[model samples]
Target chain A: MSVRHSMVKGMQNSVGYFISTFLFGIMFGVAAAASGLEQWQGLLMSGMVFSASAQFAALEFWQSPLPLGTIAMSVFLVSTRNILLGMSMTHHFDNHSTGRKILWLFILNDPGVVTAIRLDSGIDKLGYITGYGITLMLSWLISTWVGFNLSNIITIADFGAMDFAGPLMLGIMMVLFSKGSAASPIPWIISGIAALVLHEIGLPAYLILPISVATGIASAMTNRHRSHPPKGETRIKANNND
Target chain B: MTMTTIIMMAGIVYLTRVSGYFIGLQFRHIGELRPILEALPGCAMMAILIPAVRQGDIVDFTSLAVVLGMMWKTNNVVVSSVLGMAILLFGDNVISGS
Candidate 1:
């Protein structure tokens, strides 16, 4: 596809992804409000914090009046994977202007990183990243506000259903990640085991996240010999063929 | 929430999002971290998914059936989500007598 066509397609796909993801945030907001947060507080959490897992964790601990330090640590541990995402996409910004680069960096979320990796045309990397990020951010922000404002409209009976949104989204992510990969199930199995063991041991809920991440990372590193991409010209040709 | 609280929360959130971009750039020269970083998404997904799968309050046979069905039948996200929601609703009504 031409650069313009690619950019337009990227924007179109981004809009669809954003709308779906935004609905998830709205569901989260409704759940949080049901859990005791005020409508505006839920909105602010979705808008500012943006990490669903951490926000849900904070909501769970809200009644306890946990220390800010503890909350910060939970959020940091949950979000540490983004550092790797940012590193992976750094090459795409190598030729972009500094301002554009900074904006791209701000919006780099899971979907953004996945979409960036899928792009074949390098010339429109900035446009694709910008379009994807802005779409996702706006959707999340708007849906969160809507959920907060409409929390009362949703029944408490219905709120529990909204709690399922997090898992549902994660399930969808699993499906997305499984495409074109034979070894995809290995990390998933490891994670399931880690989660089961942690829960069995009665580990603090917040700590399970980091433990799962650590387990998966360690497993992936150990199995790197099985899936390492060939280097240099051979790798480039292989990628291009795909 | 108070304005101070909002500011604090916002600062923390922004720091998480932006720190990767800024700090990751500096570490590019290290070279060794790239392969490790490439595997991070799988790690993160596992982190989010594992505890979710094991939640005592939530997980049940019906949900497991739903997960398996979704993973096996279509693996299409939209379809799987619908299947999951349907199964959860059915399970809830049957289990809770609601």
Candidate 2:
């Protein structure tokens, strides 16, 4: 598929999770309002921070005396997984300028990264990632506005099911990512087991992604002798996606 | 104080989001590490998803199965997510006996 075609597919994938994320943003907006942020402040923060876990954690520290150090640390700790997520995309951004790739990091989110990694091996489809990221960001901001204005519609179903949307989105996208006989499942299994065990053992949340990604990469490297990438997997020209 | 806190928080989060890519680009000489890089998308993906799945109740497990089954049958991303959510919301409520 052409890079443009891939980009369109990615946007469609983002839209698939749009409702869940929008509801999630609305929930965050309601939380922000309850935490003493004004509607504009909530929208502004959502746009800039662009992280659900960080924003939600910040709400817990929304006292008259804001604990800047503690609040920033919590945010940092929560989002540190993005480090691994961004690293995984580095190969996709190889041909782009370093500055451009770094700038692209601004739009990185769970959904965006999942779609962005689907960029064909030889192609630099930065536009695909940007399109996916922007769609999610706008949905988040717009739904924040809705939730801020209509917090009364909080409803009966907003408690737990709303939260599963994130994971469900992840699960659905994983299905998309793993769909084929060509890819090996062993690395995925290893990474998942390692990460889950580490998490259950109470490892710091920030450490999970890096360690798990490292584990998967290590296993894949060791297994490369067993199953190599089919030929033409090298850095081919962008024109030969087929 | 609030504005300062917001900016600081966003800055910290943004740093994590970009740090790995930053390090990767800074030293592109590590051609030997390409397999590790190739392994990352799947590893990182499962790493992110597994914890949530493990923490979930039966509703989540069922919904996951529904999504996977739908994907297997239809090969559609958008519809699978929507249908998954619908099943999750329906199943969650039904399981709760509400």
Candidate 3:
């Protein structure tokens, strides 16, 4: 497809999660208002930061004295996924120049990156990813405006069942990524259980993602030989290696 | 929050988003590591979602199952999600005896 066509497709695909993104924006906006941030400040943060999880954590710890260190640490930790996401998408961006890559990565968010990953590599990925990211960013900014103005009338309960929308989005992405993955379901199962156990064991929330990811990778590597033995599976293994 | 804090947070997030790409660029020639790299996205998603699922009760689990099932069948994310949310809302009301 042409770049413009791919861009339009990207925006169209984003329509799927529009409600969830809107609700998320409202949640952040309400939180920002509750935490006493001026509307412009909230919108500015949304524009600059562009991460719901990090912004939410920042608002949670927003205070009179402003524990800058704790807030900063929380933001860093909550967004650790972005690092892994960026690394995963490195192949797609490898052909682009550093300036273009950095400029595009500024608007990176989960839905955009995950959708890019789901799309066939043959497509115009740069356009699709950029279009999707820009759409979500605009939706987030507009929803923040709505939620900020209506904070008094809105409450957390107003979200209700829609609260699950965010989780559902993540779950869908997981399903999409797992469809033709080289690692099989074993790694995913291991990672899920590992994350649960680590969280139960009182591991710091920030440590969970990296550690569990490492565990999943290790499990996949170890089970690789068994799943695809050397005899007749060499071709499959070679393909997987690529 | 102050402008300083906002800028700092944005800087930190931007770093996380782009640093991985640069790091991966450094190791591009390692063909052997491709499988591991390919595995990162799904595994990361699993790790993040599992704990959140654990926190929810029956309604959440059922709704999640519905979501996954719908995705598996229809492969339309928006449709699956709307159905899942509808199920969740219906289940929430029913389970609460409302």
Assess every candidate by TM-score.
Answer: 0.70, 0.55, 0.61
After superposition on all CA atoms, what RMSD does each candidate show versus the true structure?
A: 6.9, 9.4, 6.9
Alpha-carbon deviation at B76 in model 1, angstroms: 3.8
DockQ of each: 0.38, 0.41, 0.44
Could you tally the backbone clashes for each prediction? 0, 0, 0
lDDT (Cα, tens digit) per residue for candidate 3, span A25-124: 8656765776778999999999999987678656655667776776676577557667767777777865667788889888877777778888887677
- Stretches off by above 4 angstroms in model 2 are A1-46, A49-140, A143-154, A179-183, A198-211, A225-242, B1-30, B96-98
Docking class of 2: acceptable
Give the per-prediction TM-score of chain B.
Answer: 0.52, 0.61, 0.69
| lDDT (Cα, tens digit) per residue for candidate 2, span B1-98 | 87888888888888878886776657755546555544555676677667768888888788888878888788776677667666665785587677
- Deviation of model 1 at A130, angstroms: 2.1
CAPRI quality level assigned to candidate 1 from its DockQ score: acceptable
Question: What's the C-alpha lDDT at position A161 in model 1?
Answer: 54
Q: Predictions ranked by DockQ, top down?
A: 3, 2, 1
Query: How accurate locally, in lDDT, is each candidate?
Result: 0.61, 0.70, 0.74
